[model samples]
Target: MLIQALTPADKSPLLALARRIADAGCNLSESRVSTIGTEVSLMLLASGAWDALAKLETALTKLARDESLRLVHYRTGQRGNSAQLPYLVEVVAADRPGIVARIVEFFAQHEISVEQLNSTRYRAMQTGAEMFQAQFTIGIPADIHIAALRDDFLELCDGMNLDAIMDPVKF
Candidate 1:
């Protein structure tokens, strides 16, 4: 099952949530936690027997009501193996609106699937200049011409004055 929770940043219920999952005989398989602005967000995947999962659902419900957390959960299946190659794309540029949208659109046009993306905007400590940085983990179809794709991606970044790099993910 996949669970998501959102609460005020100052009130972290990570330990409580983990404890409940364990008490319900569930194994946490994956999790992502982040603080965005004033809210803390959590995404967790847990696996267990059907009865245990039902127990977890009940526990989570009570916890949500007691803690006033925004929570959602649903059952999900495992991901199948893919034939695409994993690549990482990184970009750093002057802070501007639409940068992420433009990059995502570029990949979408080529039928590339973005597995994960993390981006941030901050001021440079040295120069106080606003900057934007983004990292994308994408799956590129094996049949795609890498050389031509790289050239095209670089060309797009160059046009926007964004420094970028595209490289295969190494284990």
Candidate 2:
């Protein structure tokens, strides 16, 4: 199941929310929380039986209403478990729009899928140049030629004047 919650950027509400999920017998398989400005956003994946899910639904509803938190919850069905190789790709370049889109399109053209991506843009402390950086966790099909892929990726990065690296993701 997938659960998303938005609450005040305080500690108590989140603790209460976690307790509520636990009391309903749901196990949090994966979760991520981030603060955007003054609000805290949470995305969680909980696993359990239907009855426990029902209890969790009730608890979440009450938590949202009583605590003034905004939330959404639903069953997410099955997950993707691929036999593909996992790799981490990192790119850094001068800040510019469409960098992410262009890189994603390049991956799509090669039939690769991105499982997770984190990107940020900031000014370099010393150089004062605006820079963009992205780290992507991608799944490469077992049949793909890793050497060829790396070469092609490097060539593309060279054309874009970006610094990048692609390597296996270690457990």
Candidate 3:
């Protein structure tokens, strides 16, 4: 397993690494790529020796020079068995930059972990304005205060002038 953190500016480097992993006869088990502002994180799970990923590291290091891309972090190991907690949050509003950052920051501050997030944008027929909607599946610790989370989220929505709704979901 090779988990890499990178910037979106140097996508080619990531592609190159992926190709190398494939060529090294490794089976790609799981891969996820996401970005918030200029920061991009890639998590990949593969079946093979960690040594098979050495070349990938060197290639990414070189590619980071001119692109100002930073290899934020990497881990080579297997995952331990664990349990997951489930919660869901969804928001809809006019599309604009910084929305993701703001929401993610709030989650971070609240010590909330997002398991899955899907966001989309389109023009609204009535207003012809860019409308955005985001759905987030989060992991809430057993002790987290749900009512507090809801109140805070509503406050955030009011500040952002957007509509936000959070609910306890069965997963």
Q: Count the backbone clashes (under 3 Å) in each candidate.
A: 0, 0, 0
lDDT of 2 by residue, 73-148 (tens): 8888877787799999999999999999989999999999998888888999999999999999999999999999
List clashing residue pairs in candidate 2: none
Per-residue alpha-carbon lDDT of model 1 for 11-122, expressed as tens digits? Answer: 8789988999999999999999999989999999999999999999999988888555899888899877878999999999999999999999999999999998999999
Candidate 1 ranges beyond 4 A from true positions: none
56, model 1: CA deviation in Å?
A: 1.2
Candidate 2 is scored at a TM of 0.90
lDDT (Cα, 0-100) at 101 in candidate 3: 88
lDDT of 1: 0.94
Error of 3 at 90 (Å): 1.8
Worst 10 residues of 1 by lDDT: 60-69
Candidate 1: Cα lDDT at 82: 72
Better of 1 and 3 by TM-score: 1
TM-score of each predicted structure versus truth = 0.92, 0.90, 0.57
* lDDT by candidate, in order shown: 0.94, 0.88, 0.73
lDDT of the structure predicted as candidate 3: 0.73
